[model samples]
Target: MAGLAGTGLSGAGAVGMALPAPPAGPPAQVGGLRVCERGDTTYLLDRSGRVRSLTYARLVPDNRLWVRQSYDRAGRLTGLSVSWSGFAGRLLDVRGSFDARGRLVRESGFRARGVTTPLGSYLRAVPRGLTC
Candidate 1:
């Protein structure tokens, strides 16, 4: 499927069938992370209005992800991960997390979907991730 390939994930069937795309309306309100579209980029903004990460919402029909960026509290890009949503076996993951000093310390989950992240990822992270 076009949506599956959009994630940069090889082997569409490898990950599993992609779920039909969620209706693209306004970007979903995800806790302390506010989403906004600037050109083709979808950015996840921290409460202070700094860019915490940038994500792509390409292929609206069955949205997928390219590369995901995560920032430290100091506004440094700390980690990267591939998140996918809508697949029959879609994964919710953090990929990695770093300390305020920007050092990778602990890791939680990973599925390797490479598509847009499912809500589980945010639900799991933002509760503790968002500070200030």
Candidate 2:
């Protein structure tokens, strides 16, 4: 076994996937962000600089899976979301806003069916552990 274990499921309506064993160590940091990897999975730290969100890519169809964290301006985490896209081509749209204190006040999401949506009234909140 590698540093991880995975389940391979197949047959009727079954999806085959790989699940890595968790990493061992304190979280790693890059710039102001903390980084972690479980096999091929990646994670980001919160403003308190703790691992708060994770992302992984599917090995079979080679799709991207995203796990994200939201935070207030004061550096407190407020919310989180997860999304995925496949080889057939898909765009994921997730939107959320935070208060001055960094608390997420509202959030909304929609699937992009070959077209992007207008910015409209949605507000974007930067996650704590990301460079942007």
Candidate 3:
């Protein structure tokens, strides 16, 4: 039987089996720095080569942003936060949970002060269909 990775869930479900490989040339440039891109998605890598943030333009023309947190040697996320721009600006204070394999199993968010009040506990489930 095909495992989750074989079934196209590898790398946090960012890659699908039928999807073409990322471009083979040098990474894309943003702000005079090289960035990794998959199709139109772009990722910002820190000096240590870890992903620091992501920026993508949605199909509807709205831009999405994600900020990643640092982790300690023990593999726990030392901090977590996220923000999106649309309808003004919305910020989320995020916390992540990981399984034994270090894969993120869940995440919780709270609306930061000065942002619009989020309905329901400010928590939303990560949809399986989402990439990145």
Candidate 4:
């Protein structure tokens, strides 16, 4: 359990794939990263090929809006938002904004009331300007 709702101060997620390699296809542009699709799921990758974001199908089959991400033209992350789909369509998490120099300005996060482990969750995921 990590933050669900702050400034981009948490989310120290490592750049790695959560699933197997996507099926072959020309890389699609996702914000400042390259995106590839595997069936209904899409993966965002940085210039170095690190994972950045993921968008997979929801109950609506082709509903790619279940997750969203944005970045500056130079590849700095600007926004990221998520929500469940259909009847359960509720916002799950968000992060946002970058300074003129492309630094993360602020993020949206939750308090994480019962989270114990400082791993995986935002508690352990320090943002760019802050020390954990």
Clashes of each: 4, 2, 0, 9
Error of 4 at 49 (Å): 0.6
State the displacement of the C-alpha of residue 77, model 1, in Å, after optimal TM-score superposition.
0.9
lDDT score, candidate 3, position 39: 60
RMSD of 1: 13.8
Cα lDDT of model 4 by residue, 44-83, tens digit: 6667665455454455553323555554445454555544
**Tens-digit per-residue lDDT, 1-132, candidate 2:** 332335343343243555689887766666666775556557566556455454544434657655555444355556656455677665565655555665557758866676453332222343444441
TM per prediction: 0.38, 0.38, 0.29, 0.33
How far residue 93's Cα lies from its native spot in candidate 1, in Å, is 12
TM-score for predicted model 3 compared with the true structure:
0.29
Compared with the true structure, all predictions reach lDDT values of 0.58, 0.53, 0.49, 0.47
- Candidates' RMSD to native: 13.8, 10.9, 16.2, 17.1
Which candidate model has the greater lDDT, 1 or 2?
Answer: 1
Across 1-132, the per-residue lDDT of candidate 3 in tens digits comes to 245546545665555447678777765655544576566545555444555444444333454545444344443344434555554555554556555554666767766577654322322222222322
Task: Answer with 1 or 4, whichever has the higher TM-score.
Answer: 1
Q: What is the lDDT of residue 52 in candidate 4?
A: 55
Q: Runs in model 4 with CA error above 4 Å?
A: 1-25, 61-65, 68-81, 85-132
